[model samples]
Target: MNIHDRPFFAPTRRLALGLTGVLLALTVAGCASGSRKPQPTPLEPVAALVSARQVWTQAIGPVDPLLVPAVHGGAVALANAAGMVTVLEGETGRVRWRAEAGAPMGAGVGFDGRRVALVTRANDLVVLTERGVAWRQRLPSRTFTPPFVAGERVFVLGGDRSVAAFDAQSGARLWSQAPRGTEPLVLQQAGVIGAVGNTLVVGIGGRLVGLDPDDGRVRWEAAVGRSRGANEIERLVDLVGRVGRDGDVLCVRAFQSAVGCVDAASGRTLWAQPADGATGVQADAERVYAVEANGRVMALRRSDGARVWANERLLHRGVSAPLALGRSLAVGDAQGFVHLLSRADGSFLNRLPTDGSAIVEGPVLVGNTLVAVTRNGGVFAWRPE
Candidate 1:
């Protein structure tokens, strides 16, 4: 008998028949009782604490829900769903250059100072220089996380729980390494890769692995969260959002599990605190900021992982990842409102409105300018006065 076809309790054939009848009766009873899943909390208007104005706006075509803009040097590189890549002046929002890909973009517009890399929906990697297309290569598997470019290498996390590196100048494959354990269930929106010193930090399967960039060898691995519960769904604990790093500290959040920090060099866990967030965490020098799955914004002490403060007024507002900006933390909501909260107390400091569409991805902090992209392909930049 298929385990999924029948409830676990109905192990015997006779019990399975009876369980089916009982389940039907219970389903009818539940319907009669008018049981329903809990609805998200309604959004409430809050008075702005400070004034934030948009410096500029640009229409770049609709962006993929999983991809975020890449900022390098003083330019921001963005790829829309239609395979158009635009490089803009970070402060002025002036379009510097634009390129169109042969296929729809799947993963990134990961930019270093030299080259830009993006994956196509056809599972091909396309690299571009300032002039035009540099090279194109096929990936071994699909990818949702944006490609990470550092030094002379570009790194990507694939759907098959593997991390691969390629030459930044040429499209040659450097090395590919898969994570340990069973082919664990992966989260669709929960993988990230970046460089911290000489180590490549990858968030996958509820853990963070520090890999040597030169050879893609696992230098160390640290668990952000562990699997628990009876079923695979409940046991899912992949790390969500971007892995945050500040100096020697690295922080990450696990889906519906916990948030933790670790020493980047030694792989020693600094601290892990229970947190229920679907998105990732961002860090400044002192605090790590995160949005809980239900839209609660939280600030945790970076040193020991203690709760600094939390604001729940935006609960269920579909908050994006938090961006740490000096004394404030900025997060976007479903309604295209970019909220700035006090880093000290989590109080609302200011709010800015976009094109009235949902800000699906978190804002990127380029220098002092906060850049945000809405679901409708609206891009805006703001700086705190």
Candidate 2:
């Protein structure tokens, strides 16, 4: 039987309803007031620095609002709203394999070579292999981020304020750990986890934690930002978007708070700059890129977090995370337009339009192609010309 179809206890249903109401209230209060300025409309393209043409397009299924494509081993894996998983060839967009979970999916696809992991709407973890279904384990709570598979373990961050690791091969629970602090209500789109060397780097509620992947013990912890307000709504500082790491330097952003980088090994704060954004930060070898809540994209020197450049042309366009593509940076907007800007000076170089729906997640760079999935369930691949 599908896990989501299982019955819920009366008390559990009540608690879920209460949490839903709280989340609704928080969403309403989070939007800026009438005092805020209007956003700029997308400007006309100046000149084409590099031509981008769609290589292929495919329809997996209806869009799973929370799912983003996972790329590994020359393949891009996508989970649609209908609980179907499709693996497409990176170069040609050909379907390699397709499978179904028999239930709706909660989060995106997480993959590592032979194994793929996904979370179900019922809060269960499902692992798939080339052969077929490997194992399925019920999770303690719902998850939004993809299951992070590294080494022999798969780590999942739960909305119940915990990070749990399971044996990748056997689906046995290895260990579970939570952050240290009062659990402020977390955003549904908030948590992010990845591996930095041997440690599992996880961002939850304004703090970045490095966990020992083997035992789920705390290796190091650093605050990306802290709450200063009195009420729960005022204290909702979460690490937004995906945690970015280039070498030993890891950078992340806190919702309505700050963006900073730290040493992945010891959790030493390299430098932090005050900024407000719901999107995450991206870093190359030398600089970190951030899109503020207002849609202004800023580039900072990775060494000391000095401001390199800021582009305000796309202000309030609902930009996704900035993707570093060679000498240019790419960002997708709410209107499904991908804008390419100069990496050195933030000058607008080119723009391309998709299905006119929002690219809910940041574009994934696969080899020389940019893979973008729209909210309308359009998966597109563009190659530079």
Candidate 3:
């Protein structure tokens, strides 16, 4: 579900099913007028500036906010909401192994070459290897982000905004932490957890925090976005995923607030630009790309977060987070079309058609293959030829 329909947390009374959802629903209903929305920006003819083709596709059933393709080299592990996890050889769209997690999945498919970690709908952290389900243990709360796998350990960023680490082999709990934040509402989206060298980093509220992976000690914390709204709904500024990483640098998009880059090595805020975007960002060495909440595309210079260019051709099309691909960038729309744009100018290059459903998550790149998953369970792979 999109942000306007995503669930939110109220500190005192957070319901499991119906009411936590109404928090954002109330925001949308309370904020917007009854005026009918105008149509999405019409598509124009595209002159293919680059040669790219969809090479192969696989069906993994429908997906949701969960199911980020956990990519390792050319292999990608993906799961559907129904608990079917499939590992694919990305280069050829070949299935390496498909297994069941034995329950409905809440969030998942965190793969680090060998092991896969998933949070089940029952609040269980399930770890799987090629041999099958390795170990399963219950978690303290719900999790939306996929478990982050690194250094032979699996990290879980919980829906309650806590951080925990688990042993990949025996499912042993190493450390659990509750970051210091008193925000009443949080976005029900993918968890942002990653590693930069020895420091373990996680997105908690509006800050990207570096913690000692061994003992859950806070090394540093950098604020990428700040809360400023009159109410909790307007003040939601948690950093979303589709983050761009170059060595120690992480380029991220703060929900409904700003887009910024953080030097994960030193926990320093390199620069943050005021950007009203809901999705995350993708970056290359020179520039970072983001899709605005209403579908405007932007290219920001990587050095100081300067706006390089803006393109509104896809405005209101429900575009996914961008995937930087060589001289072009790729994004999928709600209509199941992948648009390739010129990296230097944000101009349209070409559009590729899918199964006519929304791309549920961001586009991913594995090896030379550009990958995208749709809401209808279509997994497509494209390659430049």
Q: State each model's CA lDDT, in order.
A: 0.74, 0.75, 0.79
- What's the candidate order when arranged by decreasing TM-score? 3, 2, 1
Model 3 spans > 4 angstroms off: 1-35
Model 2 spans with C-alpha error above 4 angstroms: 1-22, 25-40, 182-184
Window of ten residues with lowest summed lDDT in model 2:
9-18
Q: Give lDDT tens digits, candidate 3, residues 1-385.
A: 1111001111100112212323343333225445666578888998887878889999999875567777887798898888888899989999998888889888877887788889998889998877788999898776878898777678899877789988777889999997456556667677478776677778888888888878788999999998877866677668787688766688898877899988877889999988887778887778889998789999999999888999988888888888887888889898888999999999888888899988877778888998888878999988976
**If the candidates were sorted by their lDDT against the true structure, best first, what order would they fall in?**
3, 2, 1
Of models 1 and 3, which has the larger lDDT? Answer: 3
lDDT of 2 by residue, 335-376 (tens): 888888888999988888889887867788776788888878
Which model is ahead, 1 or 2, in terms of TM-score? 2
Assess the local accuracy of residue 187 in candidate 3 as a C-alpha lDDT between 0 and 100.
75
| TM-score of each model, in listed order | 0.87, 0.90, 0.91
Q: For residue 362, what is the lDDT in candidate 3?
A: 70
Better of 2 and 3 by lDDT: 3
